[model samples]
Target: IMHLPFRGRLKLLVASLTAIILLTWLYLLAGNLENGRSLLLSPCLSETPEARVLERVVLESRVREMEEENRQIRLQLNQLQGTVGQPADGGNYGNAAWGASADTGPEDVENTAEERANHTECPRSPTILKCELIHVACVCAGHNASRDVVTLVKSILFHRRNPLHFHFITDAVANQILSSLFQSWMVPSVQVSFYDADELKSEVSWIPNKHYSGIYGLMKLTLTKALPSDLTKVIVLDTDITFATDIAELWAIFRKFTDKQVIGLVENQSDWYLGNLWKNHKPWPALGRGFNTGVILLYLERLRRIGWEQMWRLTAERELMSMLSTSLADQDIFNAFIKQNPVLVHQLPCFWNVQLSDHTRSEQCYTEVSDLKVIHWNSPKKLRVKNKHVEFFRNLYLTFLEYDGNLLRRELFGCPSQATSESVRLQGALEELDEDDQCYDFRRERITVHRVHLYFLQYEYTPAGDDTDVTLVAQLSMDRLQMLEAICKHWEGPISLALYMSDAEAQQFLRYAQASEVLKNRKNVGYHIVYKEGQFYPVNLVRNVALRNANTPYVFLADVDFLPMYGLYDYLRHFLSILQLGCNVTKCYVKKSRVLNTFQKHCMQSSSKLLLTHLYTSLSPCRPRYHVWTKGHAPTNYAKWRTATTPYKVEWEADFEPYVVVKRDCPEYDQRFVGFGWNKVSHIMELDAQEYDLMVLPNAFMIHMPHAPSFDISKFRSSPGYRYCLQTLKEEFHQDLSRKYGAAALKYLTAQRNI
Candidate 1:
């Protein structure tokens, strides 16, 4: 037999009493209890009128009053018995064991309170909190353990006595985790109905527990049909909750709403989140907030009137679970229900189930909510902080909260002293920092340095005997000259082509660059150039221009104000040898220029006079005006060139490995000549990677002259233009040598034939 509680039994009794009273009254009024089928009768019989009619009426009234009193007493007895204990075997009826029935005398009615007090000692039923079902159905899913649900059950039975009966619904069939917990938390008064839905499976079976087979829903439908005619509502809850306190408080919120509305917890509204829900095919009202049925209060009559249970069964059979699974089964159905009929849902504070993240950014995130009746924790994030102190404090707070009563008295400062020893240590450190009036240094406690952080200082020196007025091609702005000229002076390399701004203008550019913020922290290498209109320096022209401005016997095409990192003397010696060598060598060029408005400046190799002569039949002279720079195409077979390198090969991270480059200037000065523009290093790198035999001096790498100063060409022309004189000499030599060698060889051959 399906067991219904006292409420259901009372409903049946009341119906039966009403029916009997009506029939008997009608029969007596019709003067006959039998054969009065045609007319409804009252219990006022004329045949027995002479037989003390007035007395009988008085007796009937007394009997009715007595019956009413008896019913009231029975209700009280049943309530007391239910609170103290569950009915033994078949419900608490039939036997006169626990309490009295209508047949019992007034004595039993008098002792009902005494009986209730006595039964209260039968274990369970500690603090009685009133409860009424709000949501009739809820589903808990996910394959993970649901320990919170077990705790929730314990709180309901032992603490609050709310849900008279609960239907534990899940797609998981007897999940060991949830099953074990349920058994452990089972109490006397609350009945747990478990429905195993192992039979229901779907094709898209990724979801572990699926109720798409309609078995669980059908089972609930059966239960609803067999409901002992008492319960007007049902409630459903998910398993992912921690019930640290009574749930009666949550249920009471729903009870205030009338049966016309289905009440649930409100999910905070945000358009972004709602849009995603709409995409997921969940029924979210376009106009208002959505609800989370984590705890739901449902009205059964409303559902029955709409045939909701049958409709759920139909949808389940039609294989609609896949589309609905995005929001999960229970959520989807609840959302649909709300959309169809707008319901009243309310939101609880986040403390009810606060979602914790990596650092817990919420206000008062670290502070434990003393009034937090439940928490979701979300995931394992709370346990993963590196600060041991924070973790210790968090653990202590959670532990204290897990148990009953306040362990630490609150201070006037709103701080609690009850904490773990580890937490205390951390707190002490924090207090020290606070007292010192300083902020905690997070970096000092957590950072470390290694070998990669080491740096080498490049020292520079120049011999005192060296010439002070030696012309050095330095492309520099005035500020850089200040930083680098002392070293240039020490090296006896006089500034020749100082391509730069005056000190004041350079200072202004420096301030402007700093204010722009892009180049503020970087080294201003000074040779950075931006061409004006009509100033295209086709690589070769720019080099010729810089070289043309020089008046020294030997010029090093250098950048503005860049001091060689170190080993400058050795580099110059090597360079001198290479200059003496004419054209029998190859080298790389390093183009060091910052991004300008759009275009890039050309190379160091562009200015190499010997290389230019060897590669180009026609050469252009550097004009003071209207001349552009050009970089010559790299010579074929140059890729095979090799060089010897220094301890630190200046060409770093190139495709080539470092090899020593013979210092032609220092030893074999007759094998090479000076090259110019910026790409000279590139050529050297190309040859270096190919492992060529031609010596490339890797030591004492050049410190490029940055934007060397412009000269008054008029004054340069007035001086005995050394560059022009050299070009004239080259032209004279080529003409004289070709004539002399060819004519002599022809004359000698003709004489030998005549002989």
Candidate 2:
């Protein structure tokens, strides 16, 4: 700068200084803008080798400082938000700070505190997007509790994938234990809270106490009020239960209930309800009417609509209470309520709540444990002991507690690794027992005739001569000896009689045959006695054995008590001869049959056709009978009988009995069926399964004798063993047929009867 006046010199110096300052500021701003652009382009910072080395050296210290800062910020935030105070009962429902949602408001905060004070617990706010929230409840308060709350919780956690909020209604001691256990476990998405049963008792004080044990029966009644009001549905489980499948599957049952159905439960599998609770109640079976409440899906909204308090009040009403048994207090009341309003109940599959003890007693109804969703240890003995089924479940319970992933997978989802071999052996042994017990005899004992006996006093015999192509097979038991004598004497064709008896009966029959003068003279009659030891009379097996012995192409499966009329054998021989000559007939049955009681000798004396016509006319009020041969004076008119044989099509399930005539090569009778109920039914069902055609004879019939019904037949409905055997045989028949012909076999067997 140039020398000037003092004022001008001062002004120039100030201007120069101000320009320098402004220029410096612009340069710094440009540099900062470039750095910002770089940062935006390169999101991840790149460091030089020296910078990386410096970072590695101070990483731990820097992390500590950052964590401390975060902790201070969280502490400040928590202080501002206010601490979630402990519940009044000293039980923490969940991690409150971590579970509080962003949507939580001041009202929600106040409500949460109030809920804690009221001793009512709520689930944590759902964190995961689209995750389903399921609420489950259970009561554990009794001296007989073999399983602790931990085992029950573990079972639920092991199987469920969706978020679960468990409400454990229990005593104070169990509440503390469960709260601590759940806190220590800290399972994600699974929050549990313990509700004191005392709280439940206080809330439901209006309910009349029927001296009910603890809160076992009453907890379910108060569930609508006890659980958080936000929940719409909850699955109620017994503490004795162990889950085998995802509880979400059970929770989904709420979706299936109709508008009118308030609860979904399984029927009691055993007759315990029928025998003990129902007693003499009509319109209800022992097993089907009552539902087992071990596992129930409660629709809280629907239950509330029905007035939960009203249910409690009904228990106090003597007239209504008397309709139920106090033995199963809540269960009986629920069943009685359902009985009056049947539409309020939806029956779940028995697989959901299988009563192990009940299934064990009736092994026929036993479902394998692997297939079940929940196994209820109803029997106290089962929990305490190490039996075949009980031991495996106990070990599984322990594995769940340990959280042994590998062992739990093997025991829970898969079959128990340890039980595999034992189960296989047990299964094999059971199959062997089933085989041995199914028929008259398991041992293939030789059948031999001790003597040949016959009675031909009222006979007109026309021998078959050289045409010995037809044979009659009849199965005889203790009561049909006279009927057998008449059949053997009257039939003029080849006959094979299978005397199905025990050893003692065979000895008596042999002596009786040897002393008979009529039997020794008849060359056409032959007797084969099969001796066996069994509780049930295997009539079908004997019939099959007798048919197998016949050498003829055509065989007649006749009842030993039925006497073929005069021209039956002649008509059958002609029919078979025609069939053998390409008539395309597989079976033929008599359209008209006569049943002669002990006092009705006139039926046997009259013309078979005339006898049927007279009987049909005499019994005017009764509809004409078909398919079954009953012991009565009922008959079919000759015109109707003749009209019935007018080339009608024979369905697989046609009522025509196999007693008429059939090809020897037809499907043999199933021998697995035991006792008298299914002897004839099984044979007919099999014939139907095989799609064989049966025709009715136009002008022929047989007369059944007047022997008294056996003890097995008369007491069939009253006997348990008999009923069991009947049901077992029916299942076996369906299974055998289905195995061979697929499920369509059942349709074939049940087709409409005609011809």
Candidate 3:
């Protein structure tokens, strides 16, 4: 009905035409819009353009999938961080990326192990790889030396954690046989090289081991021909002996110094040279002084550069001629060298490379060393060898190693695959059960075998006249008897007990004592009737008597003034057990009065009430003395004592009261008691001579009974002026002995009860 105007009349016709065109255009547009909607809704595309659009959609979907995987990995990393308390790569992303590259699988780990086993060396070394190389060399001229050299090598190689190569330069080619036997075993980090006569260059032109002109000639062959010139450094050992401990620690000590080329393990053996020399040209510098050359660290490079080889050759020629004319050998030349070159060497610990002769020929010798690195048996042709005492040498030999046919092999190389060390077995002796024999009841028969046996010898006498106060004396006697009874009742069979009297007037007392069921036929209990013309030191007489009478493994001297308790046995047994375990000596201590006093002050409070109160009052008569005792309080400075336990406690009770005085400078005392007092104290204190196996046990009763007549103090009143003389002796000599000897003298005194 509407007409588009084309200017009035024209509008009518244009309107009609416009209307027709609009209607037609509208219909066509509707059709095209519907087709587009259908194409957008359809799952399948027909045109190339639609397919191209679908490809774009597929690529976007793939990108979203990759993003999801990355998110999962990040979540896993966070979870791992929570568990390990650290980042997966130990921190930063750079390390993590690198770690990812190398982490193939466990199969790769196995392959690497196989490669190592099959002789493939890896170029990529581990960052933590460490090297510990030790070179050992020894000179062997004959017989047992080959065996000893092998043993030392074995000991070192057995302990080595890193690879070690041992080169032995011996005149005896037979050593290669021994070396081959050792090498045949399944051991890592070890190699053996033998330098025989055929390998060496001899200036003298002699057949190596059969007959060297002398010691110098032998040394010359070793220096000039046998040893390698390129050998930079090495530990040189002598033949013979075994090790009691590890040598690696000694080696480490040498390694700590940059200038360790000429160090040697030293012993107190050098000190004995003074007596040996008898002023023979001042004993060869190091000869009577410092290190022993038996065990040495030679810087082969330095040695060669210094012309040591040439020097030795020239010296050998001269010494060989001199020896043929004068009968002296290598020691003289060595002595001269030692004097000339004093600063070239350093002395190591005594335990390393010790000479067996140090324990044998030297006075005050120490037979037991805690750890042995090397052993030098340097005396086949010397005076000590000529004067060899088999018993002494046998004991020394037994002490160093767990003996067997293979002990030589074990000492030098370490135990064979089947051999086990017996240190634990020896230590187990402290226990009351035999590990070897399950059927043996060690508790009943040999219990406390290593415990110290304390003895207190006592004698009784009634003064001739009743002119003096006898109550103190009688009371003292009863107290002594009660203390002895208490100790006997408590310790019983573990300790030895004895009583002696010179006067037959006390025959009834003796008869009753001898008849007493406790004393009759008892192994540890006995009585003696000694008839002496005049008064003598009771302790000295008793000790001499006990040494003769007792057959027990050990004995200690007890004073009559001490009252022993049952706990003493247990304490001492435990203490000695630890010492035996550590291969050390247990020191016996008299429980101190001052320490007990401190216990009474702080511990005796109602809240902390302990047995210290009763122990202090009961054990006071024992007269324990410690340097810690102070006048202010009982010296409670028990910390000064070498306690067996970490948190220490005072054990034995001792009295400050002096024992009987022996007359000094008296021929009888010295002649009768050779090992008593000063001599004994000196020997016990000797750093060299002392046997650490013996220990003083604190647990048993070292009970002192002042009332007991261990000494006939009544004789002091009867003899008048003799009282002052004897009192002076008691105060000066006996007290001094007590202070110096401590409990060691008690062990000897305990012997008196046996007498």
Candidate 4:
């Protein structure tokens, strides 16, 4: 039942041929008869035994050929039917999570949706577990839609009290962007899926206009086709709308719906629907003022049963016949359909969808309503819309945009002081992956530590920012606490520190932190402890612990032994905020040499390091010591860095372990590199494999406080077997990366060899 013409006709051909073949066989089995009730069994009896056998064999061969033809035709029919799968239970999803089937063909999208109208047997993922989820759908087709979608979703999460499911009708670019965001969020209440917008638009030869993605907006009408048919009801929204109250209250309105009302909406406050916005202005036909499609409570099941596909398409083609393209936007199509079928539309309160366009007489709704439940920026001008009270709505949106979603976390723990380690549950329980696969065996053998005790203790509790987006993340051993205050003082932002220590060492550190002027009672710094259970230091595990716990939008992954330069935190924030949404950062941090080998340059925020420089034309007191420079830092290009004011790109993704100020959603550290050697290298290599652009920030620098090598490093250096194991592990890692990336892995090999 796809919109495939040839396939439909081919099915008809098969049915007609089958009927004709049966009739021919029936006639051949009987002798010819002229009169009614005459005997007709003479054909088989008149034939000799050998002749009968030969005739039967001939018929069997012909039948076999016809069956083969039928089989080939059936295969072609199947090729036309692509995936339309449903979401599983609202909890824990793997590769086949949400409503998206892992097996859905990317290339098999149709021009116009046929929806397999009579498909009584809906396909669902066998692995999906079912639980209740509040379904929400959005049409996020273009670039800016992702940003708007984030704020829209953020507002929902901030206000909702139930588990959420999102069905995004999006393009390839937006899908990748939102996917990374969703993964990083890890909100237990949220689930997201992507449907191909390009797939639905693939065969369309023309469009209404470039703005509003033309008919892409109208694609919401195809929700039954785009989303899981099993999802009976959903609230569809525009990315530009923000809810000001608990979504549960809005959801409860469904109880007020009559049996015939399939779609719920708020009537338009704009005079455009009345054809009075401009002189000679003509608008789409509607019952009184048209209803806004920005906030919709769609009854998907009722829509499917009502022949929504045929009704909408026929209505759309009829409307478009007289015009070149639609100007009223996608809402025009909905308004047109609802004009004639008023029984199917349910009117919601105007407060649920308060409009803010100049053409809209929005003040009328404001006067009638006591509260603003939802705000819609339906105009193309958005914030610049000509409404009397636009500033209030604009600020409301900006508040949600700047809101730190971390504070909305569902989990809150209150551990009593008397609870002993044995009595308390372990934080971040390790998954016992089956060792049946060689890859799984390799990981288990290499990983010596697993438990991540997040926020084991806190010296102070600090909010994310008055308005900031960066969190500094570092990992260290108990012995390396010398510059904790210096680093904390240097960066006046949130810092998440992961330390490898015993229970006693953690208590000692917290007591010490409490007593210090710079560190004591500092609300901005979070301490996570990974207890050393007599195992070689799991440095990457510690790094992952800190990175995962960072609750800010951006994180600066530096070493605990390093101090950031003055103005670097604010500069990094300013730099990231202006970066066209801080996209595709490959070189997120500047690579600076160790302070032990170079001049010690500190922050102006606390104190500055005075240094005597050798030959430098610039005013910088800090300079790189070429004579004592470490290996693998040649990629940082210190010579270019000395004079360049602009950021530079590092061609290699691996080997160059530069400090990074990356988004909190970055790829996690490869925990397989438990000790020290390739932990950071493997992370950057994976980033490179994902094709992220690495750039070296010009002003950012992490002044490393050089110290004696750790016990793990000493062991790695002194023991030959340990070195051999690390080498074998490195090779194994490369092999796995090769298998995952195929020929792309060869480029990494080339880069590694060059390094």
Q: Pick the candidate with the highest TM-score.
A: 4
For candidate 3, the lDDT comes to 0.39
What are the per-residue Cα lDDT tens digits for candidate 2 across 248-356?
7777666645565687777665555555535563322222336778888888887888885576456435434444334554666566565554456666666677666
Any runs in candidate 2 off by more than 4 Å, and if so which?
1-431, 434-468, 582-602, 619-640, 644-648, 654-658, 748-755
Q: Please report the TM-score between candidate 2 and the true structure.
A: 0.36
Return the lDDT, model 2, position 412.
26
lDDT of 1 by residue, 56-104 (tens): 5545655676679978976875574343222231111111132344344
Segments of candidate 4 deviating more than 4 angstroms: 1-132, 202-207, 368-370, 411-427, 430-755
TM-score against truth, every candidate = 0.28, 0.36, 0.31, 0.46
Better of 3 and 4 by lDDT: 4
Prediction 4 global C-alpha lDDT = 0.65
Per-residue CA lDDT of model 3 for 4-62, tens digit only, reads: 34468776778899889856644443334331332232345534685456444544555
Name the weakest run of 10 consecutive residues (lDDT summed) in model 2: 448-457
RMSD of each: 30.5, 26.9, 30.3, 24.9
Stretches off by above 4 angstroms in model 3 are 1-131, 141-143, 148-150, 171-176, 198-201, 204-217, 220-225, 256-287, 314-331, 358-368, 371-373, 379-755
Full-model lDDT for every candidate: 0.36, 0.56, 0.39, 0.65
Q: Supply candidate 4's per-residue lDDT for 640.
A: 63
